[model samples]
Target: MPIFIDGHNMRGISPTDLEKIVNSPKDNFGITHLEVFYNESEDKLYCVLDAPDEESVWKHHESFGLKCEFITSVKQIKTAKDLKEEKFQILGEFASQLSHDLRNPLSIIKNSVDMMSIKYKDKLNADIFENFAKMDRSVIRMNMLISDVLNYARTQSLILEKYSISEIIQASLEGIKIPDGIKLVIPEHDFSLKCDGTKLQVVFYNLITNAIQSIGENNSGEIHILCMKKDDIIQIDVQNSGPPIPDEVLPKIFEPLFTTKDHGTGLGLPSCKNIIEQHHGIIRVKNNPTTFTILLPKDVEKLSSITV
Candidate 1:
């Protein structure tokens, strides 16, 4: 039986648009089951490809400015589920239970911080106040983990929305406190496309954030963005100057919980993959020893205003 994807209300377009995305090259990877993407306006398509292992998914999608994860079981090929099942798989279940159980202590810490604020109202040193803030950040990180587990355990139930692609990137930059020294190189031309704001934001954010992190503190790099119209489709390329992503590690970057960063959740990039696939867009990441680039081809209605 064909996998009946039920994201009707999720997409901000018509069913016919989705049918077009489904017919794109990426959707017909000829695999028993694979991942594909569509544009919010329903005009473009991209493929994530199917491999015998999860490592390949990471390597393939990463080249497109997207991310992926590693799968250890045959059940992973099924479209209905992915990383979500792993959250409750044997020992994974216990880990989640433990993370959830720790919430009580985090709440207590927050409460204690509140109490200290009151008890030392006027006498609290600036240093002490700063410590409370530190504690707060720690609590937030823990909560983030719990949320990741839950999200991973569930199919994002992809809530696709028709959104302006260009605006999403700008919006992401606006809200994020980008580290200093890294400069964002905006495209010289105006380009617009449609996609889910939340998911697409993740896609741009992860790529941009990764570029900044690659150079570390005090180091500066130029991040360039190129958005253009290729006939009826939209193509986006984000390039950064930094150390090249090692050819060996490139393939496994998308696997869940796999990360080169010590504190990485390994979910940001993977989540990006899911969102792009749903949008009927293609994403690829590449490097030339000193520069890195990501590619995304999205499908959206060719508006007269944008066509010229």
Candidate 2:
């Protein structure tokens, strides 16, 4: 068994009520609640549990109708003292190191796949070639997962630059291949803002990719991206003609490591949220057409000065 620490926003739940729930001997997921630390002021709960794996931890929490902000496997339990900031710092460092370590091997696998593709272009049969293509897709997906982890873990300062909304959306779309039966529409109007163009591009890319995935392959869908400037804030909406997000899953969609997809790393939306907040902006989602809206400050320089 491994030790894990999971976090949850307590909402209005009191410590006594939480204790009562945890005291129940419900080992459905083979998870044992060992210790819990509650921050009354912050209304955040940290639970130390003995579980079979991270998935079991998630199931255990889900069984209790609890949404976890994050669930991380820890090697050892340090202290029971209240150290919220330090706890997050430790988790961030662990994620950064883990991602960095995995990239080297991933690169080797990717390069080997490329070489094989070139060398066996003429010799391989159709089935073998298809398998090789699958392998290449897997490598690409793994690389994407690694990038998401690194982006979420590392806290790098923004490189503020002037860029038009149209330009950013265009650059983001260049990397993605829109599947057949899917149509993408971009806003005719453009707005300029001073922000981290690279990070912003990642936000748009994730949103657009999610929209495409939601539409699926067989369905004829349209992805409409709309932009507008209101007062000192600029709003961007990425809407898709896909099934609405389930009511049960909507609230936890932005939480880290929360996903309904089989192969999803569950860090994409969280990373987007982090980047938007870093720019003094907010990212939110709504159903009834499946729209993701982002509101960012029009003048980052002024916002930065005021915050300082």
Candidate 3:
């Protein structure tokens, strides 16, 4: 069986409409729909189908009044598990490519806006200046969302190495602006662990950034980070002085695409979860003082030697 993948620009199409069209009879098109990749954010769909030829795949979609942008034959290396893994990789690649493409135009717009702001600030009225500021903020938010999506999709196959807790925390804090009213307290005890330092830095970065944002503007707060080791396990806790998450929303905090922040992409905590689990660890959150705790194994060297 030959597997063919085709992409369609499905702008403004509903899920029900897509389902009905895909399930409709082929009418001698000689193709079987295997799976669909729909991205609501981009209004695009990629369908994998089993077909006798590329024409059959084209005719199949055309019969349903849909036009496929492109179609290509793909090789199957293994059975169901391999197909699933390949599908995930394909999705990640698509997301990464789309994000990269979008950044180019966005970068141009950002530069134009910056130049205009600098060149016209004296001539622009307060209202125009405010509007420009708003647009810049929106562009920044969009960039952040794209970054989070890319990170969430590609958070796999980590390169592990030895790192000190203090070093990881310091690296994570780099480039992040901390509020003057907020105080970060880190434990003086230094501990070493064998893990993916880069990915772990992202984990701590998300937690620390979330803590800072939770405190909001003009609020004095303290973030206390502590690390401990007992036997073969090491536990790290990040406690922040901020309002507790709503009881109902607590359970869904780590769920993908779930968020409470107005401009959040909702992938931060989910990415954190993926990174932590990829390291064979567990993360938990509690509310009395708003703490996020991560437990990582001390003996990662042994686990790293075993083939997955």
TM-score to native of every candidate shown: 0.50, 0.60, 0.56
Is 1 or 2 the stronger prediction by TM-score? 2
Error of 2 at 221 (Å): 0.5
**Candidate 2 lowest-lDDT run of ten:** 299-308
Q: Which 10 consecutive positions of candidate 3 have the poorest summed lDDT?
A: 299-308
Name model 3 segments beyond 4 Å from true. 1-93, 99-147, 301-308
**Total residue pair clashes for candidate 3:** 0
Residue pairs in collision within model 2: none
lDDT of each: 0.58, 0.83, 0.79
Tens-place lDDT per residue, model 1, 127-231, is 988677677656655654554554444444545456665677786564344557888777776655554566566567667777777867568877787777676
Q: Please estimate how well model 3 matches the true structure, expressed as its whole-model Cα lDDT.
A: 0.79
Across residues 85-195, which tens digit of lDDT does each residue of candidate 2 receive?
A: 577568778887887789899889978988998998999999998787778767656655666676787556788999999999987775576788999999988999999
Give stretches of model 2 more than 4 Å off. 1-91, 101-144, 304-308
